[model samples]
Target: MSFLGFQLRWNSVLLGALVTAAVLNDVPPSYEALVVLAPVIWADRTTLTWVRIRRR
Candidate 1:
């Protein structure tokens, strides 16, 4: 195993575990909360996407 391969695999495994831990720890989460927040984030993306739609 080369240096790059070892580093990439280590990062992927570590990140996957960290994300799983965070999701598993969040009890009784509000799933619909993201549904409400989705539009807000999309609107906040950038001026380019908006310009393409002629919103501004």
Candidate 2:
């Protein structure tokens, strides 16, 4: 799979896991921050992928 495809799959899994953890743990503030940061990290990965592709 392409980098983006791989990233999407893993990100989905990570998000699911985070959601499950939050639910089980009563949604801690740190988990909330991590949940929010997940997408930002994913976005950064996407930007890096594009930069890599462009460089090649």
Candidate 3:
């Protein structure tokens, strides 16, 4: 799989786990931050991918 594919799969799994943890556990920030952080990680990955491609 490509980097993107791996990231996508990993992201999906992480998102699900985060959501589940947020609902099941008592830690507020953990789940809330994970919910918020998913997009940031995705955007950063996208930007990095493009930057790497441009350098090639």
Candidate 4:
């Protein structure tokens, strides 16, 4: 799979796990921050991918 595909799958799993943890622990800000940051990190990865693809 491509980098983005792997990232997407990983993010999905991470998100689920984090969400479950948050639910079980009453949604702490750290976990909430992680949950929010996942997408931002993914967006950065996506931007990097485009740059790499374009450079090829």
lDDT of 4 by residue, 1-56 (tens): 23443334455556567668888989654966777866755754322242224444
lDDT, candidate 1, at 22: 59
| lDDT of model 3 at position 42 | 73
- The TM-score, computed over Cα atoms with residue i paired to residue i, of candidate 3 is 0.37
Off by over 4 Å in 4: 1-8, 31-36, 39-41, 44-56
Against the unseen true structure, what C-alpha lDDT does each candidate score?
A: 0.45, 0.59, 0.57, 0.58
lDDT of 1 by residue, 1-56 (tens): 11221123343444455557659997543557446545554554222221222333
| All candidates: TM-score | 0.33, 0.40, 0.37, 0.40
Ranking by lDDT: 2, 4, 3, 1
Model 2 error, position 19 (Å): 0.4
lDDT of 4 at 2: 36
Better of 1 and 2 by lDDT: 2
Cα lDDT tens digits for candidate 3, 1-56: 23432234455556667668877886554666767876865754322342223433
Candidate 1 colliding pairs? none
List model 2 lDDT by residue over 2-56, tens digit each.
3543344455666677668888999654866787866755754422343234443
Per-model tally of clashing residue pairs: 0, 0, 0, 0
